[model samples]
Target: MRLKKRISPHSLRHSYATHCIEAGVNLADLQHFLGHQSILTTTRYTHLTQSNTDSAIVRINALMDSIHVDWGNVK
Candidate 1:
């Protein structure tokens, strides 16, 4: 019998989230998958690349444009 222990639980969590993000899953979705109570809490658990943020912003802007809505006038 042999036992191996190189990675810890926290490391596994990080690897899981990183892999998921790299696979194109959204952060909000990941937060739910990880059972996080708040998006803020999940934000701390993962790192973001500039490309990811830029792409998200682009998609959000596109969506907003499609809706023909102006957030500035929401109030």
Candidate 2:
């Protein structure tokens, strides 16, 4: 199968990093995977878009549910 359009290696790297962040991967681990010398550099490269926020919310909700905790009642 052929891609609809060509993607450069840098684009692929960016996508990988974004997906990893969305999947709740730790920033330090992601930095290691990307071979980034500084966490600040990794932060600049990864954009935490709305989808990433939504994914984080979902993960948090799942964790709360697993623990049988009421999210709204948190102090």
Candidate 3:
């Protein structure tokens, strides 16, 4: 298979973690799924992809846009 050269047994776990993080799975929960004793270890396993970063920026902008700030009312 074309993937035989690119994939290994250990790499599967890494890929699983990446996909889960990208899918919005909680880090603590993913830590449990991976049987990691420390959240630090889980953090090491997950990575933020471009899509995730973009989605976060969009969410933040949406939240900011929804807020009604009255500069005149500020004391």
Candidate 2 per-residue lDDT over residues 2-69, each given as its tens digit? 89988999888888888888788999999999999999988876897899888789989998777743
Question: Which regions of candidate 1 fall more than 4 Å away from where they truly are?
Answer: 1-6, 49-75
Look at candidate 3 and tell me the lDDT of residue 26. 91
lDDT (Cα, tens digit) per residue for candidate 3, span 1-75: 255467787789988999999988999999999999999998887777898899999999998888776986632
TM-scores for all candidates: the values are 0.54, 0.62, 0.80
lDDT agreement with native, every candidate: 0.83, 0.86, 0.88
Report the lDDT of model 1 for residue 33.
98
Report how far residue 34 has shifted in candidate 3, in Å.
0.2
* Model 2 TM-score, 2 decimals: 0.62
lDDT of candidate 1 over 3-74, digit per residue (tens): 586788988998798778867889999999999989888777778777678989999999877764467664
Model 3: weakest 10-residue lDDT segment is 1-10
Q: What's the CA RMSD for each of the models? A: 7.1, 5.0, 2.5
Clashing pairs in model 1? none
Model 3, runs deviating above 4 Å: 1-6, 72-75
CA displacement after TM-score superposition, residue 5 of candidate 1 (Å) = 9.9
Score residue 64 of candidate 3 by CA lDDT: 82
Overlapping backbone residue pairs in candidate 2 total 0
